[model samples]
Target: MEENTFKKGLIDGLPIGIGYFSVAFAFGIFALRCGLKGWQAVAISATNLTSAGQIAAVPIIAVQGSLVELASTQLVINMRYFLMSVVLSQKLKPETTVLDKLIIAWCNTDEIFAVCTGKDYRLDKRYCFGILIPPYLGWTLGTLAGVLAGDVLPAIITDSLSIAIYGMLIAVFVPAGENDRNMLMCIAISVALSLCFFYLPYLRELPGGFTIIICAVAASVFMAVKAPVGGDG
Candidate 1:
């Protein structure tokens, strides 16, 4: 049963791995253009799984932002994962050890969490490892490839690709926002706040990391209070 479950996880994870490859490729180039070396870009992908957080960190690194700014930015952007980890933990067997849980937590990415939640049964270590392995390698290798090829690609082409790279963010929010009014409002609020931070006097001087933290936290807190999740109709 464990073997079968492991294979099932590998099969299910293949698509996610492929998706990460393409997205990580874009990020690789983006990081390269941001002045990160090839190894540094690959190292970031190897160590981190959250694409949005990684992308958000680029400007912070570029400006040599303070550790406080970077740490706060990461906490705000990746805070959802803390909640996600708590939820996903319920799927583990009671006998699951702390070490195993730590390993699984390291791999508890958004897509992996979704896949686990879609399953009715408990997730064992084997299945979690199986599911995580390919995507992890794909992400790291994709970044490496991107960095190595950055110098080979034409300047105009790489520049143009940067704009299209963020299409992933659009893909995620557009469909969800179309169907959910609350989510749409949240998206709008974040965007408006972001614009304010960009254009408003004094606010415009704020570090990029803090700007994201403020925008995201403000919109989230307002929405959480106004329309709590899972409230009865």
Candidate 2:
């Protein structure tokens, strides 16, 4: 049974593994262009897997942002993961161990979490780690390859492939988003708030990364406040 489950995870994970390769390749190219070493780029993606956070940090690093600002920025941007971790913990069985949780947590990107939470996934440690290794390696290798290749590709091709990460984000959100009204509302509110942040003078001038945090938090709080009580339809 466990063997079959692991096989299922691998099969389900294959497409995402390919996409991660391409997207992480873009990150690698940009990182290298910004004067980071290939290994440094690979290490950053492997540990963080937070593309927005990484890209934000790069410019801030270039400008030598203060340590306090960097830490605060990362925390604010990554706060959503705290909510995700809480939801994921609920899906885990009672007997799930500390070691198992630690291993699984390492692969808790948006894509991986979608697979784990859909229906009765019963995601054990072996299945979690199995799904993790291939995609993780693909990301690392793509970064390395991109750095080594170094500017051979034209600008248009790079720009097109840069959308791959956005594609991954849409995939992660759309499925469960259909069934959950709260999630749908949160997404809609976030999008509306994000647009406002982009176009409204003072808000528009706010940094891109900080805008994401503001929209997310505002949308979440709005939903919590507005959710109907006892399915009072």
Candidate 3:
């Protein structure tokens, strides 16, 4: 029996959804640390699924950072989404319309992109929409859980939860680096530059948001020019 494509999307998204819960749970705790109330933390997760952007934004908000800092930081961090959306557009069925594309763009995430692109055939709007449901629910619920837990858990326990987000970041880094030597160099350069921002005099004084923007752009551009993935393929 042929399974429905929508059903296939939901099933495929399940693992990604589960993984997101664990990561989002940690993010919930981190949001609390940044002085966001429980509802605000949950709202952020519900509305925006980009964990890195959330992490970057929450701290800035906590410190009452400038609007320029918030806007520039989020733009730099999330600029990749435009690229990702463009790439995913290529995978849609020929009959897909502008409104359908707009909906897909709203729901797209890194995990969803990986799932949709891993297959060979063109995807319809049904499958694309179906796949996003589980992840969206999991992320929102996880944040809610984290917020509730943060309110009650001892500081010692909540502090221990800090490691989970770092783990999530490493999980993102390792796979790309392992597959491509060039990408590994990019990751290494980004890490080294970030450490300098953390420790070096004068450089350490730069605003956190700009420091991230500079390091990320510098490493990505240096590597892309040096290696030029698939040589313009």
CA shift at 150, candidate 1, in angstroms?
0.5
Sort the predicted structures by lDDT, highest score first.
3, 1, 2
User: Residue pairs in steric clash, candidate 1?
Assistant: none
- Tens-digit lDDT string for candidate 3 (99-215): 988777877887788667655677888888889988898889989988888757676765565566456446666887897898899989998999999999999987665677678
- Which candidate order results from sorting by TM-score in descending order? 2, 3, 1
| Candidate 1 vs 3: which has more lDDT | 3
Residue range 1-233, candidate 1, lDDT tens digits: 33326788788678677777777887898898898888988888989888888998887887788989878878877877886788788877777899988888877887778777656677877788889887888789988878878768776765665544345446556776897899899989999999999999999987665677678779989998998888332
For candidate 3, list the clashing residue pairs, or say none: none
RMSD of each: 4.9, 3.3, 4.3
Question: Of 2 and 3, which scores higher on lDDT?
Answer: 3
How high is the CA lDDT of each candidate model? 0.79, 0.77, 0.80
Tell me the number of clashing residue pairs for each predicted model. 0, 0, 0
Residue 155 in candidate 2 has what lDDT? Answer: 74
- Give, for candidate 3, the lowest lDDT window spanning 10 residues: 160-169
Best by TM-score: 2
